[model samples]
Target: MLKTRTGILLLAPAIVLMVALLVLPVGYLIRFSFYLGQTGVQTSGGFTFANYVRLFGDGFYLAILWKTLWVSFVVTVVSAITGYPLAHFMWKAAKRWRAPFTILVLSPLLVSIVISSYGWIVILGNNGVVNQLLQFLGLTTAPVKLMYTNFAIVVGLVHIVTPFMVLSILAALEKIDPLLNEAAATLGANRFRTLWHIILPLALPGIGAGTTIVFCLAISAYVTPAVMGGSGPNFITTLIYHQFVTLFNWPFGATVAAVLLAVALTVVFLYVRVLSRLGAAAPAAR
Candidate 1:
Protein backbone atom coordinates (compact mmCIF):
# COMPACT_ATOMS: atom_id res chain seq x y z
CA MET A 1 0.00 0.00 0.00
CA LEU A 2 2.81 2.37 0.89
CA LYS A 3 4.73 1.61 -2.32
CA THR A 4 1.62 2.07 -4.41
CA ARG A 5 0.89 5.38 -2.72
CA THR A 6 4.47 6.52 -3.30
CA GLY A 7 4.29 5.61 -6.95
CA ILE A 8 1.02 7.49 -7.42
CA LEU A 9 2.51 10.53 -5.72
CA LEU A 10 5.56 10.41 -7.93
CA LEU A 11 3.34 10.23 -11.03
CA ALA A 12 0.98 13.02 -9.93
CA PRO A 13 2.86 15.86 -11.63
CA ALA A 14 3.19 14.08 -14.97
CA ILE A 15 -0.46 13.09 -14.94
CA VAL A 16 -1.59 16.61 -14.21
CA LEU A 17 0.73 18.01 -16.86
CA MET A 18 -0.54 15.58 -19.44
CA VAL A 19 -4.14 16.39 -18.68
CA ALA A 20 -3.54 20.12 -18.79
CA LEU A 21 -1.29 20.25 -21.82
CA LEU A 22 -2.14 17.29 -24.03
CA VAL A 23 -5.62 16.03 -23.25
CA LEU A 24 -7.24 19.46 -22.91
CA PRO A 25 -5.77 20.75 -26.18
CA VAL A 26 -6.77 17.60 -28.07
CA GLY A 27 -10.28 17.81 -26.66
CA TYR A 28 -10.54 21.42 -27.74
CA LEU A 29 -9.22 20.61 -31.20
CA ILE A 30 -11.82 17.88 -31.57
CA ARG A 31 -14.55 20.33 -30.62
CA PHE A 32 -13.14 22.94 -33.00
CA SER A 33 -13.09 20.45 -35.84
CA PHE A 34 -16.82 20.03 -35.56
CA TYR A 35 -17.49 23.76 -35.95
CA LEU A 36 -18.45 25.29 -39.29
CA GLY A 37 -16.09 27.32 -41.49
CA GLN A 38 -17.09 29.15 -44.66
CA THR A 39 -15.38 31.78 -46.81
CA GLY A 40 -12.24 31.46 -44.70
CA VAL A 41 -14.04 32.33 -41.51
CA GLN A 42 -15.30 30.14 -38.67
CA THR A 43 -19.08 30.48 -38.14
CA SER A 44 -20.70 30.44 -34.72
CA GLY A 45 -22.66 27.28 -35.22
CA GLY A 46 -23.26 23.93 -33.52
CA PHE A 47 -21.30 20.76 -34.25
CA THR A 48 -21.52 19.13 -37.65
CA PHE A 49 -19.74 16.27 -39.46
CA ALA A 50 -19.37 18.38 -42.64
CA ASN A 51 -15.64 18.89 -42.17
CA TYR A 52 -14.92 15.17 -41.87
CA VAL A 53 -17.36 14.40 -44.68
CA ARG A 54 -15.66 16.86 -47.00
CA LEU A 55 -12.21 15.59 -46.00
CA PHE A 56 -13.02 11.99 -46.99
CA GLY A 57 -15.38 12.89 -49.83
CA ASP A 58 -12.94 15.17 -51.67
CA GLY A 59 -10.32 13.59 -53.93
CA PHE A 60 -7.72 16.32 -53.40
CA TYR A 61 -7.66 15.88 -49.64
CA LEU A 62 -7.46 12.11 -50.04
CA ALA A 63 -4.56 12.52 -52.45
CA ILE A 64 -2.72 14.74 -50.02
CA LEU A 65 -3.22 12.21 -47.23
CA TRP A 66 -2.05 9.35 -49.41
CA LYS A 67 0.99 11.27 -50.57
CA THR A 68 1.90 12.13 -46.99
CA LEU A 69 1.69 8.49 -45.95
CA TRP A 70 3.65 7.31 -48.99
CA VAL A 71 6.46 9.82 -48.45
CA SER A 72 6.61 9.07 -44.75
CA PHE A 73 6.79 5.34 -45.48
CA VAL A 74 9.66 5.88 -47.90
CA VAL A 75 11.56 8.04 -45.44
CA THR A 76 11.06 5.53 -42.64
CA VAL A 77 12.24 2.60 -44.77
CA VAL A 78 15.33 4.46 -45.97
CA SER A 79 16.21 5.58 -42.46
CA ALA A 80 15.82 2.06 -41.09
CA ILE A 81 17.91 0.51 -43.84
CA THR A 82 20.74 3.01 -43.55
CA GLY A 83 20.58 3.57 -39.80
CA TYR A 84 20.66 -0.08 -38.78
CA PRO A 85 24.06 -0.77 -40.33
CA LEU A 86 25.54 2.46 -39.01
CA ALA A 87 24.20 1.68 -35.55
CA HIS A 88 25.57 -1.83 -35.68
CA PHE A 89 28.98 -0.51 -36.70
CA MET A 90 28.98 1.92 -33.80
CA TRP A 91 27.92 -0.80 -31.39
CA LYS A 92 30.66 -3.13 -32.57
CA ALA A 93 33.40 -0.53 -32.87
CA ALA A 94 36.34 -0.20 -30.44
CA LYS A 95 35.51 1.88 -27.37
CA ARG A 96 37.82 4.66 -28.57
CA TRP A 97 36.06 4.91 -31.98
CA ARG A 98 32.53 4.46 -30.64
CA ALA A 99 32.20 7.91 -29.04
CA PRO A 100 33.31 9.82 -32.12
CA PHE A 101 31.16 7.71 -34.45
CA THR A 102 28.13 8.14 -32.18
CA ILE A 103 28.71 11.89 -32.14
CA LEU A 104 28.93 11.95 -35.94
CA VAL A 105 25.62 10.12 -36.17
CA LEU A 106 23.96 12.59 -33.80
CA SER A 107 25.67 15.74 -35.14
CA PRO A 108 22.90 16.54 -37.60
CA LEU A 109 20.36 16.57 -34.78
CA LEU A 110 22.17 19.47 -33.15
CA VAL A 111 21.68 21.57 -36.27
CA SER A 112 18.38 23.36 -36.73
CA ILE A 113 15.91 21.72 -39.12
CA VAL A 114 15.48 24.89 -41.17
CA ILE A 115 19.23 25.21 -41.62
CA SER A 116 19.48 21.53 -42.60
CA SER A 117 16.68 21.87 -45.14
CA TYR A 118 18.29 24.91 -46.77
CA GLY A 119 21.64 23.12 -46.82
CA TRP A 120 20.07 20.29 -48.82
CA ILE A 121 18.65 22.85 -51.25
CA VAL A 122 22.19 23.99 -51.93
CA ILE A 123 23.31 20.43 -52.59
CA LEU A 124 20.30 19.27 -54.61
CA GLY A 125 19.43 22.38 -56.59
CA ASN A 126 20.05 22.64 -60.34
CA ASN A 127 23.68 23.71 -60.98
CA GLY A 128 24.26 22.78 -57.32
CA VAL A 129 27.11 20.69 -55.94
CA VAL A 130 25.57 17.36 -56.97
CA ASN A 131 25.02 18.45 -60.55
CA GLN A 132 28.40 20.17 -60.71
CA LEU A 133 30.16 17.01 -59.54
CA LEU A 134 28.15 14.87 -61.94
CA GLN A 135 28.93 17.21 -64.84
CA PHE A 136 32.63 17.27 -63.95
CA LEU A 137 32.58 13.47 -63.98
CA GLY A 138 30.88 13.61 -67.43
CA LEU A 139 27.88 11.74 -66.07
CA THR A 140 25.31 14.22 -67.34
CA THR A 141 25.36 16.86 -70.06
CA ALA A 142 23.04 19.11 -68.11
CA PRO A 143 21.90 19.76 -64.55
CA VAL A 144 19.12 17.45 -63.45
CA LYS A 145 16.06 18.86 -61.73
CA LEU A 146 16.46 17.55 -58.21
CA MET A 147 14.84 20.10 -55.92
CA TYR A 148 11.09 20.64 -55.50
CA THR A 149 10.32 16.92 -55.78
CA ASN A 150 9.26 13.99 -53.63
CA PHE A 151 12.78 12.62 -53.97
CA ALA A 152 14.22 15.77 -52.42
CA ILE A 153 11.70 15.60 -49.61
CA VAL A 154 12.61 12.00 -48.91
CA VAL A 155 16.30 12.85 -48.83
CA GLY A 156 15.79 15.74 -46.45
CA LEU A 157 13.50 13.75 -44.15
CA VAL A 158 15.87 10.79 -44.08
CA HIS A 159 18.74 13.05 -43.07
CA ILE A 160 16.72 14.54 -40.27
CA VAL A 161 15.24 11.26 -38.93
CA THR A 162 18.15 8.86 -39.43
CA PRO A 163 19.81 9.99 -36.23
CA PHE A 164 16.75 9.04 -34.19
CA MET A 165 16.67 5.60 -35.76
CA VAL A 166 20.39 5.08 -35.22
CA LEU A 167 20.21 6.06 -31.57
CA SER A 168 17.17 3.88 -30.91
CA ILE A 169 18.73 0.82 -32.54
CA LEU A 170 22.08 1.48 -30.86
CA ALA A 171 20.41 1.53 -27.46
CA ALA A 172 18.81 -1.85 -28.13
CA LEU A 173 22.01 -3.28 -29.58
CA GLU A 174 24.05 -2.17 -26.59
CA LYS A 175 21.69 -4.01 -24.23
CA ILE A 176 22.24 -7.31 -26.08
CA ASP A 177 24.67 -9.71 -24.38
CA PRO A 178 27.98 -10.17 -26.24
CA LEU A 179 28.04 -13.73 -24.92
CA LEU A 180 25.15 -14.56 -27.21
CA ASN A 181 27.26 -13.68 -30.24
CA GLU A 182 30.17 -15.82 -28.94
CA ALA A 183 27.79 -18.66 -28.21
CA ALA A 184 26.38 -18.48 -31.75
CA ALA A 185 29.93 -18.43 -33.18
CA THR A 186 30.81 -21.51 -31.16
CA LEU A 187 27.71 -23.20 -32.56
CA GLY A 188 29.14 -22.84 -36.11
CA ALA A 189 27.25 -19.65 -37.00
CA ASN A 190 28.98 -17.26 -39.38
CA ARG A 191 28.81 -13.47 -38.89
CA PHE A 192 25.93 -13.01 -41.31
CA ARG A 193 24.11 -16.03 -39.98
CA THR A 194 24.60 -14.89 -36.40
CA LEU A 195 23.25 -11.40 -37.20
CA TRP A 196 20.27 -12.91 -38.98
CA HIS A 197 19.54 -15.50 -36.33
CA ILE A 198 20.42 -13.64 -33.14
CA ILE A 199 21.00 -9.90 -33.46
CA LEU A 200 18.04 -9.00 -35.69
CA PRO A 201 15.49 -10.84 -33.62
CA LEU A 202 16.65 -9.13 -30.43
CA ALA A 203 16.77 -5.73 -32.17
CA LEU A 204 13.28 -5.87 -33.64
CA PRO A 205 11.81 -3.89 -30.76
CA GLY A 206 14.20 -1.01 -31.33
CA ILE A 207 13.76 -1.08 -35.10
CA GLY A 208 10.02 -1.01 -34.69
CA ALA A 209 10.26 1.89 -32.26
CA GLY A 210 12.61 3.85 -34.49
CA THR A 211 10.51 3.18 -37.59
CA THR A 212 7.35 4.42 -35.90
CA ILE A 213 9.01 7.57 -34.57
CA VAL A 214 10.58 8.38 -37.93
CA PHE A 215 7.32 7.73 -39.75
CA CYS A 216 5.36 9.99 -37.44
CA LEU A 217 7.94 12.77 -37.62
CA ALA A 218 8.19 12.47 -41.40
CA ILE A 219 4.44 12.57 -41.91
CA SER A 220 4.03 15.67 -39.74
CA ALA A 221 7.11 17.51 -40.99
CA TYR A 222 6.36 20.96 -42.41
CA VAL A 223 9.43 23.09 -43.14
CA THR A 224 11.62 20.35 -44.66
CA PRO A 225 8.89 19.18 -47.00
CA ALA A 226 7.74 22.70 -47.80
CA VAL A 227 11.28 23.79 -48.79
CA MET A 228 12.39 20.56 -50.48
CA GLY A 229 9.09 19.43 -52.04
CA GLY A 230 8.13 23.02 -53.00
CA SER A 231 5.08 22.99 -55.31
CA GLY A 232 5.61 19.47 -56.60
CA PRO A 233 3.98 17.32 -53.91
CA ASN A 234 1.34 18.43 -51.46
CA PHE A 235 1.50 16.83 -48.00
CA ILE A 236 -1.17 16.87 -45.28
CA THR A 237 0.92 19.16 -43.02
CA THR A 238 1.28 21.64 -45.89
CA LEU A 239 -2.45 21.53 -46.43
CA ILE A 240 -3.13 22.16 -42.77
CA TYR A 241 -0.75 25.14 -42.83
CA HIS A 242 -2.43 26.54 -45.94
CA GLN A 243 -5.86 26.18 -44.47
CA PHE A 244 -4.95 27.68 -41.11
CA VAL A 245 -2.56 30.42 -42.15
CA THR A 246 -3.23 31.22 -45.80
CA LEU A 247 -6.99 30.72 -45.94
CA PHE A 248 -7.69 31.49 -42.27
CA ASN A 249 -10.08 28.56 -42.12
CA TRP A 250 -9.52 27.61 -38.50
CA PRO A 251 -12.31 25.06 -38.21
CA PHE A 252 -11.40 23.33 -41.43
CA GLY A 253 -7.74 23.37 -40.43
CA ALA A 254 -8.72 21.84 -37.13
CA THR A 255 -10.61 19.16 -39.01
CA VAL A 256 -7.57 18.39 -41.14
CA ALA A 257 -5.45 18.23 -38.01
CA ALA A 258 -7.93 15.83 -36.46
CA VAL A 259 -7.70 13.60 -39.49
CA LEU A 260 -3.92 13.69 -39.38
CA LEU A 261 -3.95 12.82 -35.69
CA ALA A 262 -6.29 9.93 -36.40
CA VAL A 263 -4.06 8.58 -39.15
CA ALA A 264 -0.95 8.86 -36.95
CA LEU A 265 -2.74 7.11 -34.10
CA THR A 266 -3.87 4.35 -36.45
CA VAL A 267 -0.33 3.77 -37.68
CA VAL A 268 1.01 3.75 -34.13
CA PHE A 269 -1.68 1.28 -33.08
CA LEU A 270 -0.86 -1.09 -35.91
CA TYR A 271 2.89 -0.81 -35.27
CA VAL A 272 2.47 -1.54 -31.57
CA ARG A 273 0.25 -4.53 -32.34
CA VAL A 274 2.78 -5.91 -34.83
CA LEU A 275 5.69 -5.32 -32.44
CA SER A 276 3.85 -7.10 -29.64
CA ARG A 277 3.21 -10.09 -31.87
CA LEU A 278 6.86 -10.16 -32.95
CA GLY A 279 7.98 -9.94 -29.33
CA ALA A 280 5.77 -12.90 -28.43
CA ALA A 281 6.99 -14.92 -31.42
CA ALA A 282 10.74 -14.33 -30.95
CA PRO A 283 11.27 -16.75 -28.04
CA ALA A 284 9.02 -19.28 -29.75
CA ALA A 285 11.18 -19.03 -32.88
CA ARG A 286 14.28 -19.66 -30.81
Candidate 2:
Protein backbone atom coordinates (compact mmCIF):
# COMPACT_ATOMS: atom_id res chain seq x y z
CA MET A 1 0.00 0.00 0.00
CA LEU A 2 2.81 2.39 0.86
CA LYS A 3 4.59 1.54 -2.42
CA THR A 4 1.36 2.07 -4.30
CA ARG A 5 0.94 5.44 -2.68
CA THR A 6 4.51 6.39 -3.52
CA GLY A 7 3.98 5.31 -7.13
CA ILE A 8 0.87 7.47 -7.35
CA LEU A 9 2.78 10.40 -5.88
CA LEU A 10 5.52 10.04 -8.48
CA LEU A 11 2.96 9.85 -11.28
CA ALA A 12 0.83 12.72 -9.98
CA PRO A 13 2.74 15.51 -11.69
CA ALA A 14 2.74 13.76 -15.09
CA ILE A 15 -0.95 13.04 -14.85
CA VAL A 16 -1.66 16.64 -13.88
CA LEU A 17 0.47 17.93 -16.74
CA MET A 18 -1.26 15.66 -19.24
CA VAL A 19 -4.65 16.84 -18.10
CA ALA A 20 -3.61 20.48 -18.10
CA LEU A 21 -1.79 20.44 -21.41
CA LEU A 22 -3.46 17.81 -23.58
CA VAL A 23 -6.83 16.89 -22.17
CA LEU A 24 -8.04 20.38 -21.32
CA PRO A 25 -7.03 21.85 -24.63
CA VAL A 26 -8.70 19.03 -26.54
CA GLY A 27 -11.80 19.42 -24.42
CA TYR A 28 -11.90 23.14 -25.16
CA LEU A 29 -11.34 22.55 -28.85
CA ILE A 30 -14.20 20.06 -28.99
CA ARG A 31 -16.49 22.40 -27.11
CA PHE A 32 -15.59 25.37 -29.28
CA SER A 33 -16.22 23.36 -32.46
CA PHE A 34 -19.96 23.40 -31.90
CA TYR A 35 -20.33 27.18 -32.03
CA LEU A 36 -22.34 28.90 -34.79
CA GLY A 37 -21.74 32.07 -36.82
CA GLN A 38 -18.21 31.00 -37.80
CA THR A 39 -17.75 33.84 -40.24
CA GLY A 40 -14.40 35.49 -41.04
CA VAL A 41 -13.01 36.11 -37.56
CA GLN A 42 -16.20 36.11 -35.54
CA THR A 43 -17.87 33.13 -33.91
CA SER A 44 -21.15 33.29 -31.96
CA GLY A 45 -21.57 31.58 -28.64
CA GLY A 46 -24.63 29.61 -29.76
CA PHE A 47 -23.95 25.91 -30.38
CA THR A 48 -24.71 24.23 -33.70
CA PHE A 49 -23.65 21.34 -35.92
CA ALA A 50 -23.15 23.62 -38.95
CA ASN A 51 -19.39 23.21 -38.93
CA TYR A 52 -19.62 19.42 -39.18
CA VAL A 53 -22.35 19.67 -41.81
CA ARG A 54 -20.22 21.98 -43.89
CA LEU A 55 -17.26 19.64 -43.64
CA PHE A 56 -19.17 16.45 -44.54
CA GLY A 57 -21.55 17.99 -47.10
CA ASP A 58 -18.75 19.60 -49.09
CA GLY A 59 -16.96 17.28 -51.48
CA PHE A 60 -13.87 19.49 -51.45
CA TYR A 61 -13.20 18.96 -47.78
CA LEU A 62 -14.03 15.28 -48.11
CA ALA A 63 -11.52 15.02 -50.94
CA ILE A 64 -8.90 16.66 -48.76
CA LEU A 65 -9.58 14.14 -46.03
CA TRP A 66 -9.37 11.28 -48.52
CA LYS A 67 -6.14 12.66 -49.95
CA THR A 68 -4.63 12.95 -46.49
CA LEU A 69 -5.50 9.32 -45.76
CA TRP A 70 -4.18 8.18 -49.14
CA VAL A 71 -0.88 10.02 -48.75
CA SER A 72 -0.48 8.72 -45.21
CA PHE A 73 -1.19 5.16 -46.37
CA VAL A 74 1.35 5.41 -49.16
CA VAL A 75 3.98 6.81 -46.81
CA THR A 76 3.38 4.05 -44.26
CA VAL A 77 3.59 1.34 -46.94
CA VAL A 78 6.75 2.77 -48.44
CA SER A 79 8.38 3.23 -45.06
CA ALA A 80 7.61 -0.36 -44.04
CA ILE A 81 8.83 -1.79 -47.33
CA THR A 82 12.09 0.16 -47.15
CA GLY A 83 12.65 0.07 -43.39
CA TYR A 84 12.22 -3.68 -42.90
CA PRO A 85 15.38 -4.66 -44.73
CA LEU A 86 17.48 -2.01 -42.99
CA ALA A 87 16.13 -3.13 -39.63
CA HIS A 88 16.79 -6.78 -40.42
CA PHE A 89 20.35 -5.97 -41.47
CA MET A 90 20.86 -3.95 -38.30
CA TRP A 91 19.52 -6.79 -36.22
CA LYS A 92 21.81 -9.29 -37.93
CA ALA A 93 24.84 -7.02 -37.96
CA ALA A 94 27.96 -7.68 -35.86
CA LYS A 95 27.82 -6.27 -32.33
CA ARG A 96 30.64 -3.79 -33.04
CA TRP A 97 28.84 -2.48 -36.15
CA ARG A 98 25.34 -2.24 -34.66
CA ALA A 99 25.84 1.04 -32.80
CA PRO A 100 26.97 2.90 -35.89
CA PHE A 101 24.06 1.54 -37.91
CA THR A 102 21.63 2.45 -35.12
CA ILE A 103 22.95 6.02 -35.03
CA LEU A 104 22.59 6.25 -38.81
CA VAL A 105 18.98 5.13 -38.54
CA LEU A 106 18.30 7.69 -35.80
CA SER A 107 20.16 10.59 -37.43
CA PRO A 108 17.03 11.98 -39.03
CA LEU A 109 15.42 12.55 -35.65
CA LEU A 110 18.29 14.81 -34.66
CA VAL A 111 17.44 17.31 -37.39
CA SER A 112 14.56 19.77 -37.28
CA ILE A 113 11.60 18.57 -39.37
CA VAL A 114 11.46 21.95 -41.12
CA ILE A 115 15.08 21.61 -42.17
CA SER A 116 14.51 18.09 -43.42
CA SER A 117 11.53 19.14 -45.50
CA TYR A 118 13.59 21.96 -47.07
CA GLY A 119 16.36 19.48 -47.76
CA TRP A 120 13.86 17.45 -49.79
CA ILE A 121 12.91 20.60 -51.68
CA VAL A 122 16.54 21.02 -52.74
CA ILE A 123 16.51 17.47 -54.05
CA LEU A 124 13.08 17.38 -55.71
CA GLY A 125 12.53 21.00 -56.66
CA ASN A 126 12.58 22.04 -60.29
CA ASN A 127 16.21 22.97 -61.18
CA GLY A 128 17.20 20.85 -58.17
CA VAL A 129 19.53 17.84 -58.27
CA VAL A 130 16.98 15.48 -59.80
CA ASN A 131 15.97 17.85 -62.54
CA GLN A 132 19.55 19.02 -63.13
CA LEU A 133 20.68 15.40 -63.41
CA LEU A 134 17.84 14.57 -65.77
CA GLN A 135 18.64 17.54 -67.99
CA PHE A 136 22.38 16.75 -67.92
CA LEU A 137 21.63 13.15 -68.88
CA GLY A 138 19.47 14.46 -71.77
CA LEU A 139 16.57 12.61 -70.27
CA THR A 140 14.56 15.79 -70.45
CA THR A 141 15.04 19.08 -72.28
CA ALA A 142 13.54 20.98 -69.37
CA PRO A 143 13.38 20.73 -65.60
CA VAL A 144 10.53 18.46 -64.52
CA LYS A 145 7.88 19.89 -62.23
CA LEU A 146 8.46 17.85 -59.09
CA MET A 147 7.86 20.19 -56.18
CA TYR A 148 4.39 20.99 -54.76
CA THR A 149 3.13 17.54 -55.75
CA ASN A 150 1.76 14.52 -53.88
CA PHE A 151 4.91 12.62 -54.89
CA ALA A 152 7.06 15.12 -53.08
CA ILE A 153 4.85 14.91 -50.01
CA VAL A 154 5.12 11.14 -49.97
CA VAL A 155 8.89 11.30 -50.32
CA GLY A 156 9.20 13.78 -47.47
CA LEU A 157 6.88 11.80 -45.23
CA VAL A 158 8.71 8.56 -45.99
CA HIS A 159 11.98 10.21 -45.04
CA ILE A 160 10.46 11.51 -41.80
CA VAL A 161 8.72 8.25 -40.85
CA THR A 162 11.25 5.66 -41.99
CA PRO A 163 13.38 6.07 -38.87
CA PHE A 164 10.36 5.39 -36.68
CA MET A 165 9.51 2.27 -38.66
CA VAL A 166 13.10 1.05 -38.43
CA LEU A 167 13.30 1.54 -34.68
CA SER A 168 9.96 -0.18 -34.09
CA ILE A 169 10.90 -3.16 -36.26
CA LEU A 170 14.35 -3.30 -34.70
CA ALA A 171 12.83 -3.47 -31.24
CA ALA A 172 10.60 -6.34 -32.34
CA LEU A 173 13.45 -8.11 -34.13
CA GLU A 174 15.59 -7.98 -31.01
CA LYS A 175 12.80 -9.61 -29.01
CA ILE A 176 12.90 -12.67 -31.28
CA ASP A 177 14.86 -15.66 -30.02
CA PRO A 178 18.02 -16.62 -31.96
CA LEU A 179 17.46 -20.27 -31.12
CA LEU A 180 14.33 -20.25 -33.24
CA ASN A 181 16.43 -19.88 -36.37
CA GLU A 182 18.83 -22.67 -35.40
CA ALA A 183 15.89 -24.94 -34.56
CA ALA A 184 14.35 -24.28 -37.96
CA ALA A 185 17.67 -25.14 -39.64
CA THR A 186 17.91 -28.34 -37.63
CA LEU A 187 14.56 -29.35 -39.16
CA GLY A 188 16.11 -29.04 -42.65
CA ALA A 189 14.56 -25.61 -43.31
CA ASN A 190 16.52 -23.39 -45.69
CA ARG A 191 17.10 -19.68 -45.18
CA PHE A 192 14.07 -18.58 -47.19
CA ARG A 193 11.86 -21.18 -45.53
CA THR A 194 13.07 -20.31 -42.06
CA LEU A 195 12.60 -16.61 -42.71
CA TRP A 196 9.13 -17.15 -44.06
CA HIS A 197 8.01 -19.61 -41.38
CA ILE A 198 9.98 -18.42 -38.40
CA ILE A 199 11.38 -14.88 -38.60
CA LEU A 200 8.41 -13.15 -40.27
CA PRO A 201 5.84 -14.58 -37.90
CA LEU A 202 7.89 -13.47 -34.93
CA ALA A 203 8.34 -10.05 -36.46
CA LEU A 204 4.66 -9.35 -37.16
CA PRO A 205 4.25 -7.40 -33.93
CA GLY A 206 7.06 -5.05 -34.87
CA ILE A 207 5.75 -4.59 -38.38
CA GLY A 208 2.31 -3.77 -37.00
CA ALA A 209 3.74 -1.35 -34.44
CA GLY A 210 5.91 0.32 -37.06
CA THR A 211 2.98 0.56 -39.44
CA THR A 212 0.81 2.21 -36.79
CA ILE A 213 3.45 4.75 -35.78
CA VAL A 214 4.27 5.59 -39.38
CA PHE A 215 0.62 5.91 -40.35
CA CYS A 216 -0.18 8.18 -37.40
CA LEU A 217 2.86 10.37 -38.01
CA ALA A 218 2.19 10.59 -41.74
CA ILE A 219 -1.48 11.41 -41.39
CA SER A 220 -0.91 14.09 -38.78
CA ALA A 221 2.25 15.45 -40.38
CA TYR A 222 2.14 19.21 -40.96
CA VAL A 223 5.70 20.29 -41.76
CA THR A 224 6.76 17.84 -44.48
CA PRO A 225 3.45 17.99 -46.36
CA ALA A 226 3.18 21.74 -46.03
CA VAL A 227 6.73 22.29 -47.28
CA MET A 228 6.62 19.59 -49.95
CA GLY A 229 2.98 19.92 -50.94
CA GLY A 230 3.02 23.76 -51.10
CA SER A 231 -0.07 25.40 -52.66
CA GLY A 232 -1.41 21.98 -53.55
CA PRO A 233 -4.83 21.04 -52.24
CA ASN A 234 -4.68 21.30 -48.46
CA PHE A 235 -4.04 18.27 -46.31
CA ILE A 236 -6.27 18.02 -43.23
CA THR A 237 -3.60 19.53 -41.00
CA THR A 238 -2.95 22.29 -43.50
CA LEU A 239 -6.65 22.89 -43.84
CA ILE A 240 -6.95 23.20 -40.10
CA TYR A 241 -4.07 25.64 -40.12
CA HIS A 242 -5.69 27.67 -42.87
CA GLN A 243 -9.00 27.72 -41.07
CA PHE A 244 -7.43 28.88 -37.85
CA VAL A 245 -4.73 31.18 -39.17
CA THR A 246 -5.63 32.16 -42.73
CA LEU A 247 -9.39 32.08 -42.51
CA PHE A 248 -9.56 32.96 -38.81
CA ASN A 249 -12.55 30.65 -38.40
CA TRP A 250 -11.82 29.27 -34.97
CA PRO A 251 -15.04 27.25 -34.66
CA PHE A 252 -14.57 25.67 -38.06
CA GLY A 253 -10.88 25.09 -37.44
CA ALA A 254 -11.70 23.34 -34.21
CA THR A 255 -14.22 21.22 -36.07
CA VAL A 256 -11.60 20.13 -38.61
CA ALA A 257 -9.16 19.33 -35.81
CA ALA A 258 -11.79 17.21 -34.06
CA VAL A 259 -12.47 15.30 -37.27
CA LEU A 260 -8.78 14.66 -37.79
CA LEU A 261 -8.50 13.36 -34.25
CA ALA A 262 -11.45 11.05 -34.83
CA VAL A 263 -10.01 9.68 -38.05
CA ALA A 264 -6.61 9.05 -36.48
CA LEU A 265 -8.14 7.31 -33.46
CA THR A 266 -10.33 5.10 -35.64
CA VAL A 267 -7.44 4.06 -37.86
CA VAL A 268 -5.18 3.32 -34.89
CA PHE A 269 -7.84 1.29 -33.09
CA LEU A 270 -8.62 -0.85 -36.12
CA TYR A 271 -4.95 -1.30 -36.96
CA VAL A 272 -4.06 -2.41 -33.43
CA ARG A 273 -7.03 -4.80 -33.26
CA VAL A 274 -6.19 -6.47 -36.57
CA LEU A 275 -2.54 -6.74 -35.61
CA SER A 276 -3.37 -8.12 -32.19
CA ARG A 277 -5.45 -10.85 -33.79
CA LEU A 278 -2.65 -11.59 -36.25
CA GLY A 279 -0.10 -11.70 -33.43
CA ALA A 280 -2.23 -14.20 -31.54
CA ALA A 281 -2.58 -16.41 -34.60
CA ALA A 282 1.09 -16.45 -35.64
CA PRO A 283 2.27 -18.97 -33.05
CA ALA A 284 -0.62 -21.31 -33.74
CA ALA A 285 0.13 -21.28 -37.46
CA ARG A 286 3.76 -22.20 -36.83
Q: Top TM-score: which candidate number? A: 2
Q: What is each predicted model's overall lDDT from 0 to 1?
A: 0.90, 0.88
* Model 2 C-alpha lDDT versus the unseen true structure: 0.88
Quote the lDDT for 88 in model 2: 95
lDDT of 1 by residue, 58-137 (tens): 99999999889899999999999999999999998889998789778987788899999989989999978999999999
Q: After best superposition, candidate 1 residue 43: deviation in angstroms?
A: 2.4
In the order shown, the candidates' Cα RMSDs to the true structure are 2.4, 2.1
- Residue runs of model 1 more than 4 Å from their true location after superposition: 1-14, 38-41, 281-286
For residues 157-239, could you state the per-residue lDDT of candidate 2 as single tens digits?
A: 89888889999998999999899999999999999999898898778789988998898888899997788898844799999
Flag regions of model 2 displaced more than 4 Å: 37-42, 275-286
Number of colliding residue pairs in model 1:
0
TM-score of 2: 0.92
C-alpha TM-score for every candidate: 0.91, 0.92
